[model samples]
Target: MHPSTPTITAQPSRPPPPPSPDKPPQTFLDLITSVLSLLLVSSLTVRSFIGRWQVIRTKLTSLQSSLSLLSDSPHWSQNPLLHTLLPSLLSTLQRLQSLSHQCTLSSFPGGKLLFQSDLDIASSSLSNHLHDLDLLLKSGVLHQSNAIVLSHPGPSSDKEELAFFVRDLFTRLQIGGVEFKKKALDSLIQILNDDEKSASLVAEEGSVGCLISLLDSHNERSIQEQAVLAVSILASGSDEARKTVFEEGGLGPLLRILDTGSMLLKEKAAIAIEVITAEPENGWAISAYGGVSLLIEACRSGSEATQTYAVGAIRNVAVVEDIKMALAEEGAVPVLVHLLVSGASAAQEKAAHCMAILASSGEYFRMLIIQEKGLQRLMDVIQSMPSSDTIEHVMRAISSLSVSDSTARILSSSTLFITRLSEFTKEGSLILQQISVSLLASLSISDGNKRAISGCVASLVKLMEVPKPAGIQEAATAALVSLLTVRSNRKELVRDEKSVMKLVQMLDPKRELVSKRFPVMVVVAVLTGGSGECRKRLLDAGAYQHLQRLEEMEVAGAKKAVQRLAGNKLKNIFSRTWRE
Candidate 1:
């Protein structure tokens, strides 16, 4: 029967085979990438939305709530919130509005009214009202803007709280809105009309124009102090802000501050000016605005801090040729020399740094110093300055000069320079010693100065014999390497096996970490930085032997150092150096 029915058998239809296995995995990867992209987009959108919304929400909440409270009170026209809730209100908005309105018509010595037993009832009532307002602002419930506007008119009384309130309010207004900012300006105008609260609130958030207005306030002392603060804040904010500060009478204000303000104010002002001159773009403005004269005046001021800041500012400005010429025209060189001679350690250090910056382009600064007979002055400071900070600054300046042919000529003329340099190698501070070593090394690189630099080789080697800071040791090693690399100085730098051995001792694994230790890799770099002749001397002096023996003995530390020195390129150096 099956054979007979075979012709009638039917074929079954089958569903198509499932997609390839690789296709599923590829789809999953695509989906993951799409999801990550979507997530990133969502996060960026959310952050932007939040930032814009926060500002709008803060303003809306402040305006709506205050306006509502004002409308709700029946006594709005009579006592107002200032009289009714002044004592109890904790909102900064209410306190600020009340204080600002009150100060517009009333007179307070600084912005406060002192309490007295025999005071009128009105005065007592006002005092109570102010006390309430003060409490409210102090609660941090109000925007900083409102608080600043309230204190802008200076003080209503000579009370200490008034001064404190003004200072605090200024700090808060740094983030306030345009209207509150206007109030701040108005408050500054009022304060300038008085002697108390003369300090202008020119923090980073405020306008430079606001600070300049203080100069017209007739209160010279207040104008001077506030101008300094404002300028400093502007200089710290942005390059555009610095430009605005200058355009809005920053130069005169800075000069006036240096002339009249306290030592602290003068110091801050000089720092601000220096910051302004730090950029190449601002060079012209600084030179044109008579910055050099002002800086020189400050450098010659009685205050050591003022001199320090002034010298630093001058140095930064002198980076430009025109600025340096202006400083020279203003007789800054004499003032700098005088500072290097008789000033405090900080002052002398700054003066040296200034001289270096000015002398960097040519022998301008060096010639000026030498012409003023300043070598003795520098020598004295190097010998007597107690702080290592000053020595560091001076050494950097001198080293920078050593790289210049013109300044080298000036240095070569002074016998005291060589003598002092030798002494510096022997007994200088860690930083000073390093800088001196680098200076000598750089000097020896040139044929003309080789003899002068050679004179200090022995002393530099001797200094390496004692226990030293890692930075000093590293610098000495680098200097010696540089000296030996040069054909002229090589023999002199590593003349003795003891000299090589001293460097080897620096490689000792037991070198403990100081509070601020040099990187061990840095020592290695210095050791190997020299040319074939010098590197051979160093290795022969047992430097390579010491490292190899330490690698075998101090396995962990040696591994670390090796790994560090190798970095990403270490593999290549390893294959080359350790090949069988």
Candidate 2:
């Protein structure tokens, strides 16, 4: 036993012989616990995936419900009765529905990742369709229902039918919402523009009063513009309509619009005022309302078109003497002269015409134009060789300026001014030619200027000899008379036998010349008053018969001039033959 104990001590050191390398074997309870842990993890994962699938299914169901409602809802298509009444409206509704469906599809669940481009395209298409629908509603063209009502045979005249439609539209305008009011006003404008009878009927139906009321009541720019535009269309070329507009207290609103409205509104108001003021009485009404100052202000600051209209209105109002003086006092001359150079072509033309009228008022206004450098502007227009209409306007303005001796001297002294005037007389339009020669005649009043114009004697002679307008003949003949007053210029006229013949032919009673007869006779008398050679030239051109024919007419100055020429000729022939 001692030996065994000793061995056991030694064997303990060999101990618990190295632990086993294999894992420990599980018991029934351990196995059950491991299986339960594995099953718990697997069940958690499966439940998570199942929950995700159910969430996706719920989203899909909600999407399907929304799509079903969008496609089937009657509210999506408003006013089915309207659609039935207008087949085109039905098409619009269908298109809108289809577009809405497309938009919905492109914007759902995975749209950001899959259908973003489709969404943009659908959105753009929808916007364009909406714009088209708006235009269709606002254009005021006849709808299918309106056409059907109009084309139906009945006792109603077309005018009466149109009137009924107009009344209906106006009723809608007064009673409907903003969109309906706009559409009705748009329709009224179109109808009034197309049919004169419709314009008259609308005016007679108190549309002027309604439109004026709308101008004051509606703050919408589009509505106000359409209202003013309707007023303009109704008043255009219709005196009674214009009177109605005035009587309906439209003038104050029109002027207010011109004073404070937007640019478009002001433009429309300007056009309306322009139409209404076409009648002189209406013009006085505008002036009486202190509109001249407003119009002048427009000329000073409005857009080019507005400026043109404003200047034109000023010119129309200036036909009244008091208004003319009022405009001149309001500093219209400088504004008009400013417009002459800087305005649009139409504005410039109107400005020049306005200048012509203002200049014709008196020397004060004439000098006003000159002081404002209007003469330079007129000359610039000539030098630029503008359109025919512009040329006529500028030339007329120059003629008006030339009425004053001081202004004529100022105009005649510009560099190449006489040459420019002479060129116009030589080869410009008939109006240009007339105005040019008239300017020359005015310049000829200065003894120093006659020498400058004498160089153009040939052009002057040609103008007289050519078959020209009576105004051209009158102006050219008057210039000749003025030029012949200078002794040095008489030789040029006496040598041109064609000029002599033209002067003699002007005196022929058979021609029945009124404006140019006296001037032509005076020039002939001056030319023949000199010597036997001039008288011989006249006699050879049959001046005796033409001059004798003038004696029978009731022209006092022409008769005296012809008699003086006859007396000189007879005395010279008698003296020369007796001496020979």
Candidate 3:
């Protein structure tokens, strides 16, 4: 084994070519190549780190400059700061645009939604800038509305500041001229078609009458429809404002809308008609303009709400006798009577009130009532329901009959008139009692009926003496006026200073209400009818000062009768005594 190992060792010995010393440790080229590889790698790493550092420094500098500019220029749009930073700001925007483009290229789902959200958030900052710029511009710190508009521009404003800017710009331009009016009307017309906008805000910005005028204009039908809705709002509020809406041809369009319009437009038009026709002037206008026939047609339509509104309009229009007769001639009474008998409580009330107004027009409505036998039905309602308003209606019907030849003849020929008249004195509500007393005074026109009503004279005397509510007192004063209208009744009933003095007390402005037409007229008559003793009592009650006020009122009243008959009119009747 030893001999074999020696031989193997001897064979292997080539000394492994001892390390190369004389060869200079392998050529310098190899060493150089290794060193160069390491050096190149290190240099690459340092260069990459320096590039990253430069990028970071640039971003930080841009951020600092932007903040500095924002602080230096509060109103960047109006001031010199915008120009100063324009280049940098534009560069930043370009960079952002490039970045956004790259982000879009990634094509991530919801990425666009995220972008818009960010844009919205960014708009708030822009809004601040816009508002600041606007204040500067408005305060004369800056000039040019167009400049502000250009600074903050869009079809729609995303920023509140931009909104203010847009609003100011629009206001200035819209108020400038007819050209502006057309522009504004066109813009509003477009906005009204937008589903996302607040309708009320758009409507308020559009003038009501302007919108109303559009109905007749060559403007698009869509624009006219919007205008009709705007006027409906104007008509629904205060008296003066409603008057303006009516005077502005608002009624014409509404009636037209009633004839040809969508359900919504028709509804809005009906509401406008209701408001306009609620007052006497507007009501008369509606009738004068042939609105009554259209309203009647609308009432007959299938739409329940339309019918209700139409009823209200009709009721308001019926206040005038000619209008009432016009409605009657158009066969509106039966329709109204049907509504009263078969409709909801509101419709019924409206119908009843309308019937009362129609009935109050004397002979104009008496034939209709007598022919329809509406008297018994009305009396039934008054006796059973006993509402104050219903009572007023019943009395008005009776009052109408008092002036009606056919009705009066029927009442006098039959015991029915006397019987009903007597019961009015016996069993009636306060207002009903007042009405009955008034009817008795009217019925007392006949010598025979005078004796029948004479029993209630003491009662009337007691009613006059006692303190009463204003409405009752007014009713009593009206009854007295009616009774005193007849010279025969005035001479017989106003016999003593006691009665005259009592009437003089009613002439006291403080004690008696003079606002109502009926009571004011009655007081005028009573003072005119009083004797010497009556005039003295009137003076004691300070009637002279009240008469002076009436003379000053000069409200086309019988001044001479009040002065000559009541003893105050003569004191200052057309004299300069009170003028100074």
Candidate 4:
């Protein structure tokens, strides 16, 4: 026995085989289920949770059942809401497990209140996760996740596949987290840009309602910008989409963006507004939403694109007869005039266009423009000879303002305006010629403007000779008739044989762009205002045939001018016979 006891081997106690490390979760469903299993184990075995084990067990069972459906989902791994909620869920479970283990001890390590506080935190975290999961289930986020596969948009996918996918995108938009919505919006925008027909698809899917809902995201500028821009694309995509946007109560949110969003956002919102209100039928809703004031304010600040689109929106709204007064009251006219003075050419052109629309409402807007120093701004822009497109719109604004004698007097008094306008009649596009001719005619209504306009007669005559649209020619004829009221202008016209010949050529019935009556009126005006040489000039230019045909065409003033010419022709024959 002593020999056997001589050498006793010391055996190291095998530490309880390193409590089998829980297997790692391989997928989203596996990870979620693993946590649910841990919580289930904790409820059953943790001594401190004895009283609440049934409650915790019931909660986890329901959680497990709800998530089992997620396991069956094809794209469950892509559920952003699940991903976002997972970390919180895991952290709370770990904390609860540790805390519950500690609670099993005889005394509270951190005292009773501290232990209770830890328990409250763990409990609240679990409850919050459950609540969020419930909302996710209700929101059909699982279904939405399936649509998120559209992020890549398989190049080979057919329209039907894409359509089914888009239907899911809109579902997410109807109810998804902020980041999820951003992803959905990004995917939808790309789809729209890639496929020309995608807009109508999304619109038919009620995308307008989803997008408009995001415009109220005052806390999220990026989301707001993306949403409003998406709205703009859909709105401009087709008239039907625009109607959908209007029907979806989108106007209010867009105007809200104009008030609170960034400059770029304001531009996008304005663009959306422009497209929505493009139909005059939508104007009242904008006015009802108090968008007019926001739009006017937008024209005052923000980027050039913002101002331009804002002005364009106002112009569209102004087309509604009922909203015009409300638009003016919002100070749209003054704001527009201010832009004309200081804004970029594109914005100035749009501002001018909007003001032109306001002016058409009647004397009130015209006076408003004049009171706002719009005439001064108009002259300023015209002096610069802005882009042809800009000039065309500016000319329209000036023409609108010139519709009123009061505004006309102010415009006419600016020598630079008349000089620049006269220059416009000679050069630039056909629209410029027509608008300038019309503007000059309007200005010439005041006798005092005629001398300032006499310088324009040569250009007006040149416009007639250029063979342009009938509208331009008619406007030039009217301008010439008005200008010839001044003796100096008649001299300016009759002294140039080419000018008289151009006017006579316009009398030809074959000239489609010309109104015979206008040319005849000018001839009559020349005959009434010019000397006998003018009458002989008419005869020499072969105006008699047209004059005789004028009465048949219901054109007045030609017969009198024809008689004057006939008398001259007969007198010349008699004199020739006597001499013989």
Candidate 5:
């Protein structure tokens, strides 16, 4: 290598005399601008040195590039991160100027004598600034923002413009001050609430980690409220957004807000919790962080909306089986029972659902609910006619308990419940009918409950007649089949020719998409226990041909009916035919 460059650079490349303050900087921006000028002057003044000095000049130019981009923004005055960064950057540049001067005056070569450490310090500071610059660039958040750029996609859209604006606000959220974060979050809420597309834009940016930080205890109440509100909006709108919030360690602060935040803030936090826990994979997170206990408290004392959302959140999280039992153990039951008795219509509905989940986790939980009189409270709410939704929730709770004989007895023994079930099957929505039929199916397992379900028999057959809602049709058949163990139910079932014909006609193999298993089961139930004339009515309605086709279709419950209807003489022929 040459001992020196072929030519000396500009005089600005050499170290200049030390800066003397002429006048105080009018503002922070002015101060940073003065320091930057000094750095450029000294960087060029060091033109006398080569190698290491060249490297420092390169870093100084980079720091200047990054900060200048930030300061170029029309709204630069409002950026707190820039305000904070400028002072540190100014100090770093001033130190570099001093270091350059020392290197120049040094008696030894390259400032190698006593100032080597200080030179290293100056180089390290420049490297730090370079690192900060890299972060600012990679954040995909330009401090110089809201100036529309060409969208990566072919055509520019206002939609794309809105997305660019959201990216800038997210940067503010990430590094802006308390008030900045608050304002950023407020704007985000407005944008997100305006439409779902705005929400998707923010979620695609994937930096919701700032939301968790804003939920920190030290933030002002207004800031925390806006932070959680933003979370609630994002969480409810997009799956990616929800996962982002969870991935960023947001659940801990969210649960903390739920525990200690003000009424409005708590409500916002609860909304986020309710939505996040809806994903079954995320259910365990609540109990993992002991949020379930906090939710239980919310159920006890949260506002109507809060109580409603909190109960929904608890219900959602209790889907994890281990957590299900843990939720009950955490005292969710009694509060749930209290909600069922006196909470608002919506809260009661959610509480009933949560109760059902907790009760169904184990026999121990069922017994615990019984101890709390939760079963009766559900029946009480069902009788109160709170809302169709509430009725369905209560019915679901009762049905969950009816899985066991002891609980089934408690449910079946309620005359009001049995009567309501009959009414629901006749007049309720498809969902209610399905639930009602399911309850009756479980209840009919006990002979005592069988007689009680006789009033529902007319409605069950009516339900089976409509083949559109196949779920209700299937459930109705199962319930009717279970009720067939009783003599009166079997008689009443065969008495309706229109109803019996509907069941037999559905067994035809031509209805390929229709599920024939449950319908066949119901037919077999009646044939086994009905009077001779009832069997004659089924045969007259063309049961033989349908059963033959269904048996060939390999429909379960069809073969037994084939043998029974074929009797002994034809049984051999039918069996041969079946084998062939």
Candidate 6:
């Protein structure tokens, strides 16, 4: 209304007064409520932590009680149950302590996170300790005193009393005169070699350490020989006993005996080493300690029995590939071949087995054996009418050697080799027949071998037709398959209507075709691929329905074979000739 002068416009009512900042400090009741809630949360956390701690403590207490019980039992020293359970309990305690330490470390001021790797390392260490303890327990050293008494079993002999007697004998050996110690050792050896159970008891009695000590410290050949024989007997008793002998430093002294002792001593030591190496780990130990070289030397120069034992030891250790190669490097191949050629029948058998193991190492060793004329020697063994065991070894050796194509050709070229093998298939034992047929199968891979084995086809078919062992039948079937691969062999097989029927019968749908199916199908496919007359003969023998059935099966090769047979049949029908 007053435009000229600064008109006094009606102002809008002012906004309500801004709120004041004069609120009272938090009240005591509110403070108390907040404190109570915080305390409750803290108490819950503390209770949870206490519960966890109590659980861990209870576990620790229980473990401690178990340990105390074990230690307090009077039979703890001689009871086998305690001997086994104590080590396990101790290992558990160790593991628990380790875990507790980890927990403590995790709660430390600057501790890093406990990683999975830490737990794994702890577990691995526990496992290894337990394994070592188990070995120690199984060694029977803990209960030896009781075992000796129980094993001896005299009128006045309780296990405890027997243990006392053994303890007395050990004491005498340590403090008595030289003659007394020698006599004690002689008696101990005699008792140990009485039987396997006695030997096991003596070994469990912890005589391995004493025997090894005697072998090392005494120069008496009789005592040493007897000690070696006892050790050999003990080692042969059980795998645990063998491991005990090796673990107690017996292997080194035994190897030394083999290295430098008299012929009789070396012979006994070699046998003992053989038994000791029955545990594969002991073999590794012996090879590591240079026992393999000494063994090879003994095999080369020792007497027939010595050589037998030494070569046998070599065979045991040669299971390790590196040791096998080491043996070949140390000229074992030639020595074994020589042994096979001229040694005693036992030596020859062992040498043949050793040669087979060596050859199986790889193609290189196989070739080495062939070059050493090992194969020729095996052929000679067969020619000389070796024993059944020797024949088996020789045949297996030849089978291993024949893995190489070149070796197979060389074998096939040997005079009377194939003939002898065929004769074995016809007239030998089941094992001999099986091995001979298998070798023939391998040799039959070559065309020349197929031709050579053709004459034996009837024998092979007869083996199948009769209720022979499955191994012989399977091997003969495989040999027939190889031989049937040749067209001439197919014609020969077709001529024997019985053999052709046998081949067809093997393909029956209900029969387990695990090994026979493919081979039978192969023979059928080969026969069916021949002239129409061959196909007609097979059809007459009831092969068509089986071929049709197999064509529908899941086997791809078998299906393809059926398809080929069907196609050939169709082509023959379409290309028929009609005469006026």
Quick one: best TM-score, which candidate?
A: 5
Q: After superposing candidate 4, which stretches have Cα over 4 Å from the reference? A: 1-151, 154-156, 167-182, 193-196, 206-211, 218-237, 303-305, 403-406, 411-414, 428-431, 442-475, 483-516, 529-533, 545-555, 574-580
For candidate 6, the C-alpha RMSD (Å) to the true structure equals 25.9
lDDT of 1 at 387: 66
Q: Model 2, 395-418: lDDT tens per residue?
A: 887877776777667776764777
Q: What's the lDDT for all of these models?
A: 0.53, 0.65, 0.54, 0.72, 0.74, 0.65
lDDT winner: 5
Model 6 segments more than 4 A misplaced: 1-168, 217-219, 403-405, 424-439, 442-455, 458-478, 485-501, 515-541, 554-580
**lDDT score, candidate 6, position 4:** 86
**Comparison by lDDT, 1 against 4, better one:** 4
Ranking by TM-score: 5, 4, 6, 2, 1, 3
**On a 0 to 1 TM-score scale, where does candidate 1 land against the true structure?**
0.45
TM-score preference between candidates 5 and 6, better one: 5
Model 1 whole-model lDDT (C-alpha atoms): 0.53
The residue-by-residue lDDT of candidate 6 on 486-506, one tens digit each, is: 778778877887777766776
CA deviation > 4 Å runs, candidate 2: 1-157, 387-397, 423-435, 445-475, 485-500, 507-536, 544-580
**What are the per-model C-alpha RMSD values against the true structure?**
29.2, 23.6, 23.6, 9.6, 10.1, 25.9
What digit string (tens of lDDT, one per residue) describes model 5 on residues 105-192? Answer: 4433444645666666778976865675455555555544434322232233576466666766776666556776767777788877
Lowest summed-lDDT stretch of 10 residues in model 4? 12-21
Total residue pair clashes for candidate 6: 0
Per-model TM against the reference:
0.45, 0.62, 0.42, 0.68, 0.70, 0.63
Q: Write the per-residue lDDT of candidate 3 for residues 1-580, one digit (tens) a residue.
A: 4565543312211111222323331232233234323323332333222443244334434444444443444443443323322332223333333223333344324575674455344334333334443433343322333355324334565545434543543443323234444444444434334423423343333245545666664655555665565566656655654667777678887888887777777777888898888878777777667877788777766266777777888988887656876798788777776666556556656767777777777665767866777665665555455445655665666666568766656555534455455556545556657667666554535555544454344345445544454455555555556555544445544454465455545545565434424434654554554555445555555555655565666634536535554444465455656686
lDDT value, residue 46 of candidate 6 = 35
RMSD of 3: 23.6
